[model samples]
Target: MSQVFEGYERQYCELSAILTKKCNSATILDGEQKKQKLSEIKAGLDDAEALIRKMDLEARSLPPNVKATLLAKLREYKSDLNNLKTEVKRITSGNVNQAARDELLESGMADANMVSADQRQRLMMSTERLNRSSDRIRDSRKTMLETEDLGVSILQDLHQQRQSLLHAHDTLHGVDDNISRSKKILTTMSRRMSRNKWIIGTIIVVLVLAILLVLYFKLAH
Candidate 1:
């Protein structure tokens, strides 16, 4: 049980650190990159929430204060997740506007007579904004991919460590079983030796009694 709690604590700390990094990464991003990061963040939050649920179930045996603290952290994490989702929705709406503008330009509907000077200026600005957004998204994606690769490597290392621990545990159990079997064999041998000693002592006493009886009979005669 202690081991379980310890494992949970370690996982929770790792998750918290990852979330903090992700949040920081999001702050440096904007437009589509921020939106994409938010999506990933939402997924991470889901995983975190699942862990919290597992912890909650297991923590029934823990101190009340400890359990309460865990619950509070979970709630806080959830609130942050909600805020991120809201941001995603806002970005999505902006993307829709950008898409509509692109569609109009592609369809040749943005003619000189149809759009005024002010409207053209606004369209140019939107186009430039989108171009910049795309560039940032590209850079952010590269960084995110690198971070993901690092995370995968860490997980693999952890998996290898877990396998090693399991192997060690199995080896220990095998040794324990061998020790138990040896103890049982020694107990059986000791019992057999004691039985043989008791039988030999009884035979000697019977032989002495028989000899004394014969001497008495011979003397009486």
Candidate 2:
């Protein structure tokens, strides 16, 4: 991967640190200040998400041999990012609930019907906000599930390839054993042919000597 991809990991860490600090101190800040800090946290989270996506793409572009390990690490970072986002959402939701409570408490002997209408409006707005946040969470969850499925499929392919390699290795070993057996059989046949040649030569020499003795006897007579 390029250095830009590597730098993204570090950048995410820095952004996460800043967001964590902001979240920790958010409760102590005044309402306006808390809203501003939440805005910054949301921006930082967006940057973190961008960095995560870049890292994932870079890791996936690596060769398969090394890609698995890098992808595992990337998944861990993604999980961390999910946790951070969840925390930020929780803080934002808590603020909404707190504001609703403060508004209810401050209404002080106001006209009952008007108070009811105002509270209902605020409740409707909060509900809409929650629904929007839920939709985003659902989308994120769906993407994560798809990524996990892809990883599982890759692992299965690698396993099948490993099984094929092992089967091929066994077949080559069997062929080598067959070759060795054929070599031994040919060696034994070659030795038997050599013995038969030596026996034939001995018989011919003996016959020639016998004929020579018979000729000598005829000449003497």
Candidate 3:
């Protein structure tokens, strides 16, 4: 990811957590407190939305072929943003949320001193859950990065092995040529040795005949 996009994403993540807290805690919505809280959530939502726009800008700035993948991720983020928007809308309006709003307005009565103890506790628990979820997300991202690096290393090793195999193949091709040449040389030498043997046998036969004729002339005398 580009540094700009990463920055935008970091901001978005923080805002997302904040919005989650406000929207979830406001289950009982009412009065000035609920209105003020919703306004803050809306503000955060707007900022998150602006960041999403920036991220989209950054993503689209990439080359066409590369942008496709990032765009898909951006689409998912947009979906998430829409869900957050919907949740806030649902909490702030309609008959379903009207009573809860009244309850929250009443809770403010116990304020400045006590009564929000449970509310605070619930907020704490929500924060903890969000933190744990963030941790798991970070761990998953780390594992993915490690896996990608391992895959690259394996590809490099495979390429080197392929090159070595090609070199060995070339060497074997040369050896086959040498073997053929050696076979021809041996065949030529065998033919010459056979011809030389025949000439020696002819000379031996001629000498023996001349000796036999001389012996016969001596006996006649």
Please say which candidate is ahead in TM-score: 1 or 3. 3
Winning model by TM-score: 3
Across 33-151, the per-residue lDDT of candidate 3 in tens digits comes to 88888999999889989999999999799766445555765675676688779878877765555565566567633441242345335444544564565567668889999999999
Extract clashing residue pairs from model 3: 29-100, 29-101, 30-101
**CA lDDT of each prediction against the hidden true structure:** 0.63, 0.71, 0.73
Q: Could you estimate the TM-score for every candidate?
A: 0.37, 0.42, 0.47
Q: How many backbone clashes does candidate 1 have?
A: 0
Given candidate 3, what's the lDDT at residue 157? 100
Order candidates by lDDT, high to low.
Answer: 3, 2, 1
1-221 in candidate 2: lDDT tens per residue? 34555587668666766666666556445578879988988888888888888888886887663455456556756766786687678667765465644553465213333533454455345435644655676688799999999999999999999999999999999999999999999999999999989999999999999999999999999
Q: What does the lDDT read for residue 109 in candidate 3? A: 31
- Model 1 CA lDDT for position 8: 61
Error of 3 at 112 (Å): 7.2
For model 2, the run of ten residues with the poorest summed lDDT: 108-117
Task: List runs of model 3 lying over 4 Å from the truth.
Answer: 1-108, 111-121, 210-221
